[model samples]
Target: MEPLFRLALLRPAIAQDPDRPSVELAQQTDFQRALSAASGAPDPRTGLRRVVGEYVAGPL
Candidate 1:
């Protein structure tokens, strides 16, 4: 889950931004991770872990 996603869970207003830029970006980030995971392994957890690992370790 993303920061915005967590925030959304805590405060739904984050998902209701007028322009929705943050929401859109979060969704896009989620899509990228999902796509990466889906194409990477038979076990989704393995693939998702790889992606998340890279995300956490990669340059920001």
Candidate 2:
């Protein structure tokens, strides 16, 4: 979650950089895909725990 938040916060900076690599873009895309899947699961608790852990531990 922290990673997502940090990524969101850094989006403008990343976008402004024309040198951004395709691998990094792909990684972001993959993160979003995983997040989307997690969001749709019946038990959101696990996702919540992940968010909390990330918030506390500063991303993994």
Candidate 3:
């Protein structure tokens, strides 16, 4: 939960509106663009390492 909250703080989130019908792929932010680059996304080792590092190193 802490990691998720921290990640959310790192990027600006886009709000989805079901009422509005049109959605554009062209309107993406820098964070969204970077997230889209992930293709081989299956390494829990790296995520675990980061979490552990945060625990040991304390704050950002």
**Which of the numbered candidates is closest to the native, going by highest lDDT?**
1
List clash counts for every candidate, in order: 0, 0, 0
Kindly report which residue pairs in candidate 1 clash with one another: none
Between candidates 1 and 3, which one is better according to lDDT? Answer: 1
Candidate lDDT values, in order: 0.68, 0.64, 0.60
Deviating ranges (above 4 Å) for candidate 3:
1-41
Candidate 3 per-residue lDDT, tens place, 22-51, comes to: 666555754344344432347756655655
What are the TM-scores, per candidate, against the unseen true structure?
Answer: 0.39, 0.32, 0.28
- For every candidate in turn, the CA RMSD to the true structure comes to 9.2, 11.4, 13.3
Query: Which prediction has the highest TM-score against the true structure?
Result: 1
TM-score of 2: 0.32
Order of candidate numbers by lDDT, starting with the best? 1, 2, 3
Q: Residue 14's C-alpha lDDT in candidate 2?
A: 42
What digit string (tens of lDDT, one per residue) describes model 2 on residues 1-60? Answer: 689998888777544456765555434554565566667878767985675565567655
- The 10-residue segment with the lowest total lDDT in model 3: 31-40
In candidate 2, stretches whose alpha carbon ends up further than 4 angstroms from where it belongs are 1-28, 48-60
Write the residue-wise lDDT of candidate 1 on 1-60 in tens digits. Answer: 889789878964534556655435445576496666566677878777777787778777
lDDT of 1 at 36: 65
Candidate 1 residue-pair clash tally: 0
